[model samples]
Target: MVSCYSSHGMVRQSWDLFSSMRRSGFPGDGFTFSALLGARASSSCSDHAKLLLLLGISVHGLVIRLGLHLDVVVATALLDMYAKCGRVAEASRVFDAMVLRNTISWNAIIVCYGQHGGGKEAFELFVCMMRDGCCPDELTLSSLLSSCADMAAANEATQLHAYIVKIGFQDFLQVGNALIMAYGRNGFVQEATQMFGMIPNPDLVTWSSMVSSFAYLGLAKSAVHLFDRMLQQGIQPDGVAFLGVLSACSHAGLIEDGFKYILLMMRDYKMDPTPQHLSCLVDLLGRSGRIKDAYDFVVNMPFEADVDVIGAFLGACRMRGNIESAKWAASKLFSLKPNDPVNYLLISNTYAAAGAWSELAKVRSVMRNMCGNKVPGCSWIEIGGIVQTFVSNDMILHQSREMQKMMDLVSLVERYCNDDDIICNDPSLV
Candidate 1:
């Protein structure tokens, strides 16, 4: 009953069942804790997630009291639950508390950091995983490569690629696909294409990754060509494949091609368009400067327009300074993401673009009151073989430390350029 209720997200029922089990004198074990912890992680959004997080904390207390915290399986489940709850620090604590960990344990922690843009943390954990002699699986490499892509750490990606080749994990399709994407995202599309060529019996993901690489480079013709080649080989295109092609078309202003693939995905492949597909369509329509058509398409879609679609519409409106369309899109965006400062900023930016200073000021005032804490943007620098990454919040969190780092950077520059002979009076310096 606990598993059933938890799996279906019946939070109250799951807890009631657990209470009944305890009353029935059936001792809780790792499986019981795992199931209950999973229920916490299953929470979707809004107040319910908060409620689950509180309940999950209670469960953690119970686990500690019962001495089940030392159980490797239970500890792993707890760590995973904390990670899923967006409590990275707590998750790290749980991981550090564990005496024995397996591959899945390392993976859970690595993935938690990776998903939250903690690329430096994830990489450090990967190094620890290797130092501890726990062999990494394909998913591990894939997750790390994904972090590399997100960070645009070209040097890191190249080094990871070399390590994969050394460990003979290059043949793993997941790793291969991730490497292609990482290389492409880092502006090494030719290397990505070469990697694609080297893959023996490439699967659907390999082909899709290659297509996306081309699409990202605005090589729409090449993307479409490779997509067609995949079809010719009798591999049915999935939603991702269709999304890649649609994105390619959108990037290149090939609205006809975009519509063609979207229709083909739904009609020929009998697959429903995902949110990403719709967002790409919005982009395609917006790129063509058909604002009304795009707005109408979004309104008339089977599902309501999500943040991405509305945001895309707003972006197009900004380009044209279409205040009315921007307002309309902003209204929908605000409803979809009420507390997201990005939405407020987007609308405010659109208003500024339209020279609606009064409206922009109004939005900014509202943002200051309702959303004081926005997601922090991150930046990084490589110095002396060390990658120092920081986020916007760090200024307030560690202003002195950050200032010191900046001063050190200035000092390093002075060491190289303080004399002014190398850079002074050089004609190219101008």
Candidate 2:
């Protein structure tokens, strides 16, 4: 009964049966505990993670008392439970204490670190796994590539690609898809396109990655071209693929194409628009100076308008100096995300741009009292194989002598250009 409940994902029922088993003096064995632990680990609700971790720890105690912790199956289950529950430290301890390990054990721990934003550590573990005579398979490479993508470790990703080619795993669809995403995330659009071409039979994920790569680089025509090619190849697009095309249209201000894709997704593919798709459409119309249309679309959306939708409308209103629409959007946004400083910032900027000083003052006062300090904008750039992040008002970076030299050089160039007729003063020519 316990196993059945756990298998079917009735976590509460599984726990209840587990307690009942203990009360009935039926001390569970390794298999029973594994089932319970697996159920807890795979619980869908993120808010239940802490509770699941506590329950898993109690089960771990029982496994130790019963001497089942030494069982490989039981140990692997425990390791996976700890890792999935965000207890990376505890998972590491379990991994280190294991007298015997398998590929599953190694993959679990590597993925644990990878999923928790420990990309560097996960790569180190991959190195350690190789040293211990455990040859990495497709899963290992894919996990490491995913971590590299998340961290934007392009240099490491390139090395992994070479490794994949050497190991003959490059032909595997999963590894191919991972490589595409990794290259795309690190701004290697050409390499991503190459990877996409290399795939003998590209799936939806592969097509989506290529389209997204083009979209990310602001090459909307190329992105749309790829989408058309994908359709010609008889590969159906999923929501993600639509998202990439829609995003390309939004960035390029191709409002008609955006609407056409939305209608096609609904009528042809029979796919309901996801929040991301809807957000892209809103952005498309908003960016094309159709603020009223975007506002109407948001108001008529089947689902409640989310932050992204409202933010898009508000941004368009700000650009067009539509004070009335901005106020309405700002009210909706405030109710949805009261603590978001961007919401307050956008509304205040709109009022200021429209020369509504009283409204601007009121918005500023509310922002000061409610939202506190505005978050500084930040950007990252990779140089010399390292990612360097800079934030607005960062005195440390600003004070750097190297930066000062660059600024001085820029000023000198500007003065020289202004003194001569070599540089055109017209905005379009410059």
Candidate 3:
């Protein structure tokens, strides 16, 4: 029966067959559970993991009833299922309740925590695992490094780097790539570059990481240079690598280079540019005041333009104070996203700019008829993971007094300084 399940497929069918043909002679064994768990945990079937979780619970109840030990394979699978389900709390409970914990067990829990944005918790677990005297492995280090990257934990990242070097895992390519990502994300480009140089034979992941790091640092020239070098090394650039290169070109306003890379990606690499790539191109042209060209590009695009693509064009028009173009782009954008209050506000703003008070009134009336509640345009900046959001007039709790005091201060400051050009703060003039 197991042979039949194995021949058909590796996972679900085997379990069904095994349950149906409950041979009295066949005793439940670890190998069978391991194989079944492997099949369930394999990628591409997220639903299977959920089913496995339910089955695992039933198996656990049976084990408890019979006073049987929970096998390591079943334990790991249960942990993985909970983790993948975005139920880290349950996963942790399962992990702690397990009778035996191995390297795989620890690795699963740490990775789950990291992916779920519990970076600080993951780090604490890593330290505790080390204190427990469990020999640190690459999988453990990789998971911890990913957590550090996600949180942009520079100090923790530096310590992890030292630990990796001390453990002699720095030579491993996978570990090196993870470290590169951690350093790159934490704004340590020089350190990331130094690490990249030490990699004897870099793979696609290594090259992609370096390319992304260069792009993130706004060093598009360097990104393009490294891309050329990668091609010379016969390393094929994947979608992510191309995205990094294109983004670099966009950042530096290198239009020609941007077009060249787009052509290379499509013709040379035989890879079609995604919507994001096209949007980047439109944004590059738009921000450079080539609003007409950007508009033409969108109209000529092989696929339908998405909200993002249209928004890029509209923003460019607003930047250039091209009222005609702004109105055109705004019309299309509003049509695409009527439910969005911000789009209505943008159109009204454009109409106000053009001195079309009646059109502005018309827009506001439509908004009122549709939904009287207006979601104001708010801006936010994150400082130390705390987001400070500001709207037109509404103040945060206990901050109104301070806000009033600041307004009085601003009035005093304005009386002493008069500059018409400096009077406005909208960088996008339109």
List, residue by residue over 1-430, the lDDT tens digit for candidate 2: 8889988889999999889989999999988998998998788688887888889999999899999999878888999999988889999999998888888889999999999988889989998999999888888899999998888898889999998999889999999999988998888988998999899988988899889888988989999999999999899999999999999999999988888999999999999988889989888887888888998899998889999888988888898898999999999999998988899999998998999999999988998888898877778666776666778655576446788788888997787678656455545335
Alpha-carbon local distance difference test for all models: 0.87, 0.89, 0.79
Which ten-residue region of model 3 has the weakest summed lDDT? 35-44
Residue 368 displacement (Å), model 1: 3.3
Mark the 10 consecutive residues where model 2 has the least summed lDDT. Answer: 421-430
TM-score versus the correct structure, for each prediction: 0.80, 0.82, 0.70
Question: Model 1 compared with the native: what TM-score?
Answer: 0.80
Q: Which regions of candidate 2 fall more than 4 Å away from where they truly are?
A: 1-8, 46-54, 64-76, 82-101, 131-133, 348-375, 395-402, 405-430
Give the residue spans of candidate 1 off by over 4 A: 1-21, 31-59, 356-359, 373-430
Worst 10 residues of 1 by lDDT: 391-400
* lDDT of model 1 at position 65: 93
RMSD of each: 5.6, 5.2, 7.8
Residue pairs with colliding backbones in model 2 are: none
Backbone clash count for every predicted candidate, in the order shown? 0, 0, 0
Q: Encode model 3's per-residue lDDT on 283-334: one tens digit a residue.
A: 8897787988998999999989988788777766766777788778778877
* Residue range 1-430, candidate 1, lDDT tens digits: 7989989988789999999999999878888988899888877676777788888899999999999999888888888888888999999999999999999999999999998989889999999999999999998999999988888788888889999999999998889899999998878988999899988888999999999889988899999999999999998888888988999998888988889888889889999897789989988888889988888998999987788888888887887778998888888888888888998988898888778899999999988888996776678765554566787546544455878789897886676576587667555544
Give candidate 2's whole-model lDDT. Answer: 0.89
